[model samples]
Target: MAAAPQPLAPDPAADLALRLALTIRHDGQGGVADDLVDPDGLTRWVHAHAAALPAGELPFTADDAALAAVRDLRAAVRALFARAVPGEPSRADARHLMPVEEALRRLNAAAAAVPVVPHLTWPPGDGPAAGHRAAAAGAPAAAALTAALAHAAIAFLAGPDRTRLRACHAPRCVRYFLKDHPRQEWCSPSCGNRARVARHHDRHRPGAGT
Candidate 1:
C-alpha cells in the first residue's frame, strides 16, 4: 500500500485563504483528516490564524453553531479550490465534490452574510495596514468569522496568485498548495520523494521489459 501523506510543516508565508482550504488533508491511515472536527478545533484554528483576521474579530469562542457554520464554509472553500488547480482534484473527495456552481453560491452567500466596514491600523514601524471590521453590531461570531474567511478566499482566487495553485497528486496527499517556485511539483519534499519512488517502481516492476 502507498505511504499515507504527512502533515505539512508550518508555512507562515501561505495566504490565509489557502490555509483554510488546507484544514482538510490526508490522514496517516490513507484517509482524509479534518482539523475543524469540533468547536474546540474551530476555536483553535481561529486563534492560529489570528494574524490574518480582522482586529475586532479576536477573542472568539466557538460554539456548536459556529463550528457548523465554519465547517460548511470550509467545505465550500475546498470545493472551489479543487476546481482552481491545474490537474486532477485531491483524492480525498474527488468523487464527492460539490458542483462548482454550488460552491460558488455558498461562498458568495457566506461572504455577504456579515456586513463589514474598512479598518486601518499601523503597528509602529510595521506601517499602515488595512483590514475590515464587522459592521453588524449584533452579528454572531459565526457569521463574522465565516465572512472573513470567504472574503480572503475570494481575494486569493480572483488575484494573480491564483495561477500558483496546484493540487498535490503524490501518493495519498490531498492538499492544494501554492507553487512557490517554478519547478516545485509536490506539496513538500516528502511528497516529492514518494512520487519519485512510486514512479521508479512503476517503471522497474515485473513487466519483463516487454
Candidate 2:
C-alpha cells in the first residue's frame, strides 16, 4: 500500500489545499508514481482529514459522483496554483476558473443549507481566554464535507497567506506546497535532493565550453 502524503505546512487550510493537489503523485521523469483514482482511495483521503472537520461531517463511504467532484476540484486547485506567478495578481484562465466557480457555488449552497455554529472553549492552562470553534449544524455528511473543503480553499486563496502558496520547483513534481521558511522551495527533502541531482547532471552534460 502507498503511504499517505504528509502535510507540508503549518496552517490547516493551506495544508488541505496542498493535500488535494497531491492526490496523484508524479515521478521525477514526467510519469505517475502513485494515483488515488478510485472511490476507495478518495474515501481514505477524506477520512484522513477528519480531524480538521466537524464531527460527523464526512460520510462512511464516498459515491461515484462525490469522488468525481473531488477530482474536479483538485484539478481546479492545482491549475490555480500552477498558473499563479509571484508578484502578480492571482488569476486563473477560463479552463481553471470554471471549476473554481462551480466549487464556490456548491460551497455557498452547502453553507447556506447547513450553517456551522460558532462556540468558545477555554484554553489549556493559565489563560482565561477561550478559542472559538465552528461546529456543523446537522447536515448531510457529503455536503458538510464539501463545505469544509470549500471553506479551506477560500481561506487559503482570499487570506494573506496565499502569498506563501508555491508549486514545488523540483523537476517533474506536480505537487504544490506552502513555504514554511524564507528559503524553502521544494515540497520535501526527497524533492530537494532530486532537484539538486538534476542540476548537477545538467552542468556536467556533454558541454564543449566553446
Candidate 3:
C-alpha cells in the first residue's frame, strides 16, 4: 500500500471557526459550489466576529457587546470542532446567546459524514513561517486548519497583523474572508449575482423599461 493514506488532522478550533464561517455564510451548501447559499442571520454573526479583530488588537473590548457575542460564538464553535468525533458530542452554554452552538452541533455530524481525509503535518511545530510554507503546498484541510490556528494564535499572543482578513463589498452581504483575492466582493457570487439580477429587473421593469 502507498503509505495507507494517513488519517486527516486539522486544528479543531480554527477549522471549526473557518468551517462555521463558510457554512453560516452560505447556508451549508453541502460543499456544492453551484448551490445557492444565503447569509441569513448567522452569517452576519460571522462577519461581526471576524471584524471585531482589528489591525493591532484582539478586538475584545469589555464595552463592546458585539465582541462578547463573538467570544460566545467562538467558544461554541470551538466546542463543536473539539468534540466532533463520535463517542462524545459537543455541547455549549449558548442558551443565553445565539443558537450558533446548536446549529453547529447539527452541522458537525454532517461534516463527519463527508469522508474527508484529514490533512497531514510534517516537521511539526517548527513555527508559522514553515507552517505557512506547508499550507501553501496544499497540506490538506486539517493541516490548513492547524496553520490557520497558528496564525490566529500568533496574532492573539504577539498582536494583530493585517494578513488575510477582508470585508465583503456586496450591498447586502456582510462577511469576512481570508483575503484569498485582493478584489473579492460580497462573500460569494450568490450575493453578487442576486444584486445584479435585482438591478437588471429593476431597470427593465414596466415604466422603467423606457
Say which candidate scores most in TM-score: 1
Evaluation by TM-score, superior candidate among 1 and 3: 1
- lDDT of candidate 1 over 63-154, digit per residue (tens): 99998888888788888888888878877669768888988999999999987788888888798967677876767778888998888888
Best by lDDT: 1
Error of 1 at 75 (Å): 1.3
Q: Which ten residues in a row have the lowest lDDT in candidate 3?
A: 30-39
Measured on C-alpha atoms, candidate 3 has an lDDT of 0.37
User: TM-score of each candidate?
Assistant: 0.87, 0.71, 0.30
RMSD of 2: 6.8
* Segments in model 3 whose C-alpha atoms lie over 4 Å from true places: 1-17, 28-71, 75-164, 169-174, 202-210
**Model 1 residue 52 distance off true place after TM-score fit, in angstroms:** 1.3
True-vs-predicted CA distance for residue 60, candidate 3, Å: 26
The TM-score ranking, best first, is 1, 2, 3
Residue 128 error, candidate 3, Å: 11
Q: Which should have the higher TM-score, number 1 or number 2?
A: 1
| Root-mean-square deviation per candidate | 5.7, 6.8, 17.9
